[model samples]
Target: MSRSLFDVAQSIASVERSEIRRTTGRIARSRQTCCKIMNGSGSPPLHRQGMDYGESKDVQKVHAAIQREKQEPRVGLEPLSLWLIGIYALAVFFGGAYLGRFSGSFSGDSLDPGTVPTKSHGPGPGGGGQQQTAELSPAERGKKVFMSNCAVCHQASGLGSQSQGYPPLAGSEITNGGSRRAAMVVMKGLQGPVTVKGQKYGSAVMQLWESLGDLKVADVLTYERQEWGNHGGPVTKEQIAAFRKELASHPGSFTEADLEPVPADANLPGGEEGAAPPKPGEQAKPGAPPQGSVPPATPGAQPPKP
Candidate 1:
């Protein structure tokens, strides 16, 4: 019995050893196949055959999707359309031509619509091509000065603001009368209550314009007197100089009471002798003798025979 048990034990040991060797060989083969797949050098092992078909199909789908995608955009790479390029060229050409034609010497004075550029004059007998600028009339120059300095209070229309106490210059008795009163107001300035065209103005005060000089004061007064349908005569610088001398001792601005002493028909000194002739139907003073007309025969004086 002991001998039979020993033979059975030996047989069992040999079968166990064979099973272990088979298991070791299978594990080694699997490891080698896995390394080969990882290295990208061998076909799939038999155990991984089921997964190969699925992986290859997925890779093919990914490649197809990539091939169908649009390319990335790059700036300044595509050529501009022919029509667009032509339009831009046309715009540039026309714009340049327009600017060249309308821009006159690119000067500031050329921008005024009322001003016409004077053509260059050829060399004269004196042998010089003199470029002369257009000269402004006294009234025109006065208008510019008034617009810059006095337009804020009196306004461009000559119709002053009644609510603000500025007296209107248009058709006013003070402005339409002789140059004496107007010259007085301009030279010394004005304050206090004043009646113009029967309307009273008192709140606003006028500053001294004596510093404007005789020429500017005369010019501005001439413009105000002649403008807005007033029949007052033009004022001269000589008249202004004479008036300035008369008022040399007078202090400060004049009030309405101060102006009352001066007669409405009184003309400024030197105005009749040196000032320009009044416009047609205009008068230096209402009912005054017309310029250049000889006075009627004075009280039995012998008249010249025709």
Candidate 2:
């Protein structure tokens, strides 16, 4: 019984100690508030109800740090260094040196005049070294020129529209007549009723193509000679030059009757079937011809009394 009474007393003392500590805490809090209001030794009360003021102030500092980090620029690709700059300078120097050594002074001519530039590593067809040139046959080159100039009227297949009055060049004698009369027609132009394959076309006028030049004329003629069903010989630059020289005085377009007589030595590869002979004395070699001067009229030869 005595021991039980002793335990009860110890519990009461523990309760009193807790009450004392609680009361002391309340009194100390009240005194601190009073001291703040009286402008004594205590700090002012915080505006926030339950939050810690010190910790709240520390939040602004943490926010400032975050804002500073946000304002800072982001890291990016590495800046060019001294070594990298030096390497770039060296590369530019070497590139300029190489180009200067090889480039033909950046002029109209290429690096090497003899060597033709081509897609293929081998030599070009015409032996010129400009890369624009392609390794193609004469017919192929001529086909391009023909399509650009003649295909409008002659059609892609060389079969001109009869109804439209565009004479067919597919099997026409003009194309196969060894490039003599044809070259003259191209250089000087043709007009009036022209008969091809027994069909006469008089509606359309064949315009002069002297602007196409000798090379283009030869190429176009060569292509026309070999294309379609025609089996005529290729026209050469020399043949065109010779014809142009021989007929230099004949500025006007030739009529069908004017181109009637084929020379005895006409360079017709497919023969004289429907082929018109060379213009009077303008008998030039097919591939090679004398510069100018056709066979002159027989000197002192009296004309037959009409």
Candidate 3:
């Protein structure tokens, strides 16, 4: 607050003196103009009166220039607009490519319920069957599928190899059941499984056909159920489809162990249920027959009972 205070006061005085000098210069200019008139210079044409150029005229000209500039669009923005359009075009192209790649492999659409037969099926086991319809002809379709897929494993004529362990499809109880145990069995392949024919199959495990589309899977299965020397009912592709749909989330394929115990009413013998013919030593009742009423009795006939 000692020397600093004096220096600050001196600096303020110097700035005020400079500003006073500039103000006096402008006043000197005004006085010079008055002196010019007094000395007969007459102030050097203060404004050009009637000369087509004044402040108002200059302002009007500037307005017209601004309107002209507005009428013509600015040129620089065009390249910017082009850049924006290019970005939009690239976005659309990539979007289309993404959608195409995502949906291209959808497999739900290739289903064929009634597939054309490739080779001959000759004849099937059962001729007239219960009231039902087949997606594909059982004998023909089953034969083709069996030959193509199952025959390699189960063998031709639906008989599997004994040493190979693949069980026979022909005469399989799984194929010729009264109920739909056959279809259920096919849906879930067997392992260490006993078949409808009452035979134990221990060689190879059955495989699941889950990857086939609903219709094709159904058709192939329908073919198996009704093929060969196997007299069974026709299977529908829809039933197979529905079964697979129900099992879509199942962790693993079905196995014979998962099957419900074979029903008592399932796969009953085809004809009337009759006990086996009596063995020797079993006697016929009195008046049962005129000895040979059994018709063409065997040559080893026993002596007549008293």
Candidate 4:
């Protein structure tokens, strides 16, 4: 029995030795293959190939995720819709058309709806179609001059601003008096303290207007006298000329004191010998013939027989 047991043990040891040799051989082959691959003398092992395939798949997934998250490029982009371009074109066309339709010939006169453009009338036979310009009256001409020069001070209403030291001209004793006072003030101007219509004004100084010529002075005075319900008589250029000659020696502006001596009702020189017939309800001047009265006989002629 002991001999048989020893034989069985021997067989078992041989099997174990064979198994260890087989594992050692497998390990050595793996090392040799790894070394060959490191030395570039062998193909890549199966596990390396499998790992590379897995890594390639992971890299592709990462690249796909990055591409999916990327924003669209914006630089140099253009509008793409034909409908948007059509709308823009229509807006420009209608805007230009509306301006052309409503623009009134692009003329300054067209800005005023009430202003009518004057038609040019060509000369025709019998001189019937010739354009004629209506002449402005002395008062009308004076209005233009006043608006340009004096309106800033005296105002358009003829009621001067008292607070600003501009005395009113409407119904003022000086203005409604005679032509002499008005002409004197207008030609040389007024200075210092002066009273008008019982109000005192002296803050503002009236500048000389003698350079405006005799006709302009006369016209402006005539307009002022007749305007603002003033009953003063009309002034002539001749009268203004005469007054200018008389006042030539009088230097500088006049004060209220200087004008005090002149009579209010005094008439300027160079008046017509015989005044025109007074209008109805108008008072005639002293020593003047009555309206529609017969003329007196000459000194040598006998009185007319009854």
Candidate of highest TM-score: 1
Per-residue lDDT over 1-306 for candidate 2, one digit per residue giving the tens place of the 0 to 100 score: 999999999999999999999999999999889888687556666655533433434777656655655344458955679998999999999999999997777885342113224473446676464445434455666887888778999899999988877888888888765566776677777878889988888767788887766667777777887789876666766666666677668768777877788652356232222232243235656865333436557989987898
Q: What lDDT does each candidate get? A: 0.79, 0.70, 0.59, 0.77
Q: Give the count of colliding residue pairs in each prediction.
A: 0, 8, 4, 0
Candidate 2 TM-score over all chains jointly? 0.45
TM-score of each: 0.52, 0.45, 0.40, 0.50
Model 3 compared with the native: what TM-score? 0.40
Per-residue C-alpha lDDT of model 3 across residues 1-306, encoded as one tens digit per residue: 699999999999999999999999989988998898678775354564434332343788756655655344677754357888899999999998997787636664433224443443344665343343434344455555556567788767678877667777777766655424565555556666554456666647778656655545545655666567655554555566555655657676456666656572353222321222233335556655343235556798996899
Q: Point out where model 3 deviates above 4 Å.
A: 1-138, 193-196, 260-306
Q: By the lDDT metric, which is better: model 1 or model 3?
A: 1
* Candidate 1 residue pairs that clash: none
Model 4, TM vs. native:
0.50
Q: Mind giving the per-residue lDDT tens digits that candidate 1 earns over 82-184?
A: 9999999999999999999988978875532232245667898744686655555667767876886788889999998999998999998888888898888
Instruction: Note the residue pairs that clash in candidate 4.
Output: none
Model 4 C-alpha lDDT per residue in residues 38-132, reported as the tens digit of each score = 78787765654313342333778757655655467687775479999899999999999998998887886553213122455667764567554
What's the lDDT for residue 278 in model 4? 47
Model 1 TM-score is 0.52
